[model samples]
Target: MKDEKFNILLADDDPDDRMFFQDALDELSIQATLSEVTNGSDLMKFLENNLNKLPDVLFLDLNMPSKSGMECLSEIKKHEKLSQIPVLIYSTSANPEVVEILYNMGALYYIRKEGDFSCLKAVIGKALFLCRNTRLIQPERPDFLILVDDIRPKLPL
Candidate 1:
C-alpha cells in the first residue's frame, strides 16, 4: 500500500504561529499536509466541509475567537467519525487547569507552545514521529502519545 501523506489540522488565531508551524514542519522534514483554522467555529466548518478528508492529527490552540480550544476539543471528541483522529492541544498557556481539563476531556496531548523556531521544530518532529509509530510506546514524550489508557473517557456524542 502507498504511504498516505499525513493530514494535520492546525487551529490557531495567531497568524505568526500558524506560519511558524508550517515552516517548522518543513524544516523538520516531517511529511504532512496542513490545514489551518483561525477559531473553533472555523474548525467546525472545516470539518463539516471536509468530512471525507478528516485530518490524521489536530493541533489546537486554546484561546481562539468565535469559539475556544477547549470547546472545540469537546465538540470534536463528541463526533463519531472524528473522535478516532488524535487531537493535540498546542497552546501558549501552560495553565494547569487548562491542561487538566483538556486531558480529562479526552485530548490526545496537551503541548505548551514555547521557545524559538528551532524549539517548535523539535516538538513537531517528536510529535509526528511518535504519532507515526503506534506499537512502540515510550516514556518522556509529550502528553498525547504517553497516555496509553484505552479506558479513558470516550468522546461524548
Candidate 2:
C-alpha cells in the first residue's frame, strides 16, 4: 500500500465541483489517481467494469443525474462485490437527517463541500489518510461528519 497510488473515484454532475476536487487532490502530498464520472449511471458502469481494479475510495455527490447518490449508495451497499469499498459523501448539504441516513446506510464519511480550497484539501487529505491507515470503515456517529474547521485538530498532519 505504501508504494501504490491511491485510486479515487469522483461521481459528480457539476463540472466545477469535479475540477475543484481534482485541484484539491493535486495539492495534497499523497500519491493518488483520480477517475471522474459526470453522472451516477456512468459511475456505476465504471465501477462494474473495473471490478478487478476497483478504487480504494469513492467520493460521491448527493445530487446527480440518472440516479441520486442515495440510490447509488444503496445499490453499492447491497451488492456483495461492492460493499467493501469506502464511500465518502461529498456534498454541499450538511443536513443532519440526511447525514444520519447516509451513515446508517454504510457511508464511511460525510463531508460538506465548502468553497474554501484549503478546507477541501484538509478534509480530503484526512479522509484519504484514514482510509489508507486504519481499518475503520465507518466511524462512530459523532465522528462521522468531516467538517473542514473541525478536522485539522482531530487528525494528525
Candidate 3:
C-alpha cells in the first residue's frame, strides 16, 4: 500500500485555492492523483459517474456556487454507495458551531485552510497519512479539527 498512489478529490470554487492545494500536494513525498471540481453539483456528478472508482478521500469546501459542502456531505453520507468514502472538510472558516455540526454530519476531519505554504503542506500531509493509516471513521471532537499551527512533531509519511 505504501507504493500505491492515493486518489484525492477536491471540490473548491476558488481557482487560486485549488491551485494552492495542487501545489501543496505536489510538494509532498506521498504519491497521489488529484481530481478537481469547481462546484458541488459537478462534484456529485463526478462521484456518481465514477462509482466504480471513487476517490480514497474527498477534500470538500464549505462555500460553492451551487450546492454547499454541507449539502454534499449530507447527500454523500446518506447514499449507500458513497457513504464509505472519508470526507475531510477543507475550508477557510472554522466556526466552532459549524464544526460541531459538520462533525455530527459524519465528516472525517475538518482542516482550516492556511495562507502559508508550509502549513498547508503539513496539514495536507497529516490528513493523507491519517486517512491511509486509520479506519474510515469520524474521530472525537478533540481530534476533529486539524489546525495547521497546532501541528507538532513530524508525521511519518
Candidate 4:
C-alpha cells in the first residue's frame, strides 16, 4: 500500500528529545509534517491556530510547565474533533499507573523515552502504522508497542 501523508504534533518540554525523535522519523522515511509545542498551553494555542487541520498523531510528554500532558490529553479527548485524533503519551516516566490511566483515557499508546535511535524507531514505526489504519476506535493496548508482529484488531468505523 502507498503510504499516506500526515501531520504529527509533538508536545514536549525538552528540545533535545524532540530533535532525537524527529531524527528517527526522518531516518524511517515516514512522510510527515511535524509541529512542536513546548508546553500544554502552547499546545492548546497551536491547536487553535491550526483551526482547520487536526494532527494525525499527537506525541505528548507527560510533564510540562504550564499544563501537564495528562491535562492536555484530557482536554483534547473532551473535544469532538480532537477526540478522534490519536494521542500517544511519550515520556520518561515508565510508571505503570500513568500508562494505565492514559490508556483508559483514550491514549493510543504510552511509550517511554529511550536514549537511542533504534528505540525511537520502534515508537515511530508504531505511530505511523496506527495512523495508517482507520479502524482503531479506542486506544490500543500498551503492549502494542512491544508486539510488532501481531495483527491489530480491525475496528469497524
Candidate 5:
C-alpha cells in the first residue's frame, strides 16, 4: 500500500513500556495508527472484535497478567482469521529456550525490549519492516530473534 499509516497493536502491562513505545514511534515519525492493550485477555478480545479490520501487526509482550503472550500467540495462530497478523514478541526477558519455543510456535520475531529510546526506535523500525515483508508466513530460522545485545537470525536448539 502506498502512503498508508501502518496499523499497530501493542499488548503490554507496563505503563512505562507502553509510554516508551509510543514515544519511540513518535520519535521515529513512522506513519502509523497505534492501539494499546494492557493485558493478554483484552488483547485477544480486541482481536476478536476487530476481526474484519485487524491491525497490520501486533507487538506482544511475553509477560502479562491473566493471559500470557504465549497463550495468546497460541490462540491467535489457531484462529484462522487472526493468524495472518504478524506478531512480534516484545519483552524484557532473554531466555534462549523461551525464544526458541515462541519462534517455533509461530511468532514472526522475538525482541528484547531495549532500554535506550534510540535503540528502541531502531528495533521497532526493523520489526515493522519485517512485518511488512513477512506477514502470516513465519520467518526462517536465521531471522527469528532480536536481543538487546544482538539480533540473531538463528536460535540454538
Candidate 6:
C-alpha cells in the first residue's frame, strides 16, 4: 500500500544531529517533509508563525540552549493553539527521572539518540509509522518506546 507523506519537525541545537536526522529520514519508506530548528525558542517561533502549518510530529531535543525541551513542552501544552501537536522527546539522555517527567507531561514518545545510522533509520521509521496510525497517542511506560516485535502486552487475565 502506498503511504501518505507527512510533515515532520525537529528542534535540536547540534548541527551534526540535525544532518544525521535528515539523512535517517531519507532512508525511510514513507515520504516525510522534514523541517528543523536549532533551539527551543526557534521551535516556538516557527510554531507560532505557522499556526496553520503545524507538522504531523515534533522531535524535540531536551538539552537545547535558550530554552529547554521541558520548557517548550510545557509552553506547547498550555497553549490551546499548539497543544495537539504530538511531541516526541528526542534526547541523548535516557535517565529514568527525565523519561518519567516527559511521559507524565504528555509526550507521546522518548527516543535516546542512537549512534548507529541503521538504528536511527529503524527507530525513525517505526516512530513515523506508529504516529501516523495512532495520531501519536501517548503510550504507557512499558510500551512507550518498545518496538512492535518486542512488545508483550500486559493483558488482564
Q: Where in model 4 is the C-alpha error above 4 Å?
A: 139-157
Distance from true location, Cα of 95 in model 4, Å: 0.6
Residue 113 error, candidate 2, Å: 0.7
What is the model-wide C-alpha lDDT for candidate 4?
0.76
Please report the candidate that would top TM-score against the real structure: 3
Off by over 4 Å in 6: 146-157
What's the residue-level lDDT of 3 in candidate 2?
A: 55
For model 3, the stretches where C-alpha displacement exceeds 4 angstroms are 1-3, 152-157
In order, the Cα lDDT scores of the candidates are 0.74, 0.90, 0.92, 0.76, 0.84, 0.83
Residue 95 in model 5: lDDT = 89
**Overall local distance difference test of candidate 5:** 0.84
Is candidate 1 or 2 superior in TM-score?
A: 2
lDDT-based ranking, best first?
A: 3, 2, 5, 6, 4, 1
TM-score of each: 0.83, 0.94, 0.95, 0.85, 0.89, 0.90
Residues 1-157 of candidate 1 have per-residue lDDT tens digits of 0155789999999999999999988776656788899989999999988889898888999899999988888888899987777888898877677676677788776666755765566667666766787532323334453221321232111
Screening candidate 4 with a backbone cut-off below 3 angstroms (N, C-alpha, C), the clashing residue pairs are: none
Using lDDT as the measure, the top candidate is: 3
Give the higher-TM-score candidate: 2 or 4: 2
Q: lDDT, candidate 5, residue 53? A: 94
Q: State the displacement of the C-alpha of residue 52, model 1, in Å, after optimal TM-score superposition.
A: 1.2
Candidate 2, which ten residues in sequence have the lowest lDDT sum?
148-157
What would the TM-score be for candidate 1 when compared with the true structure? Answer: 0.83
* Residue 58 CA displacement from its true place in model 4, Å: 0.6
Better of 2 and 3 by lDDT: 3
Q: Residue by residue across 131-155, what tens digits does model 2's lDDT show?
A: 8887855889998998777876774
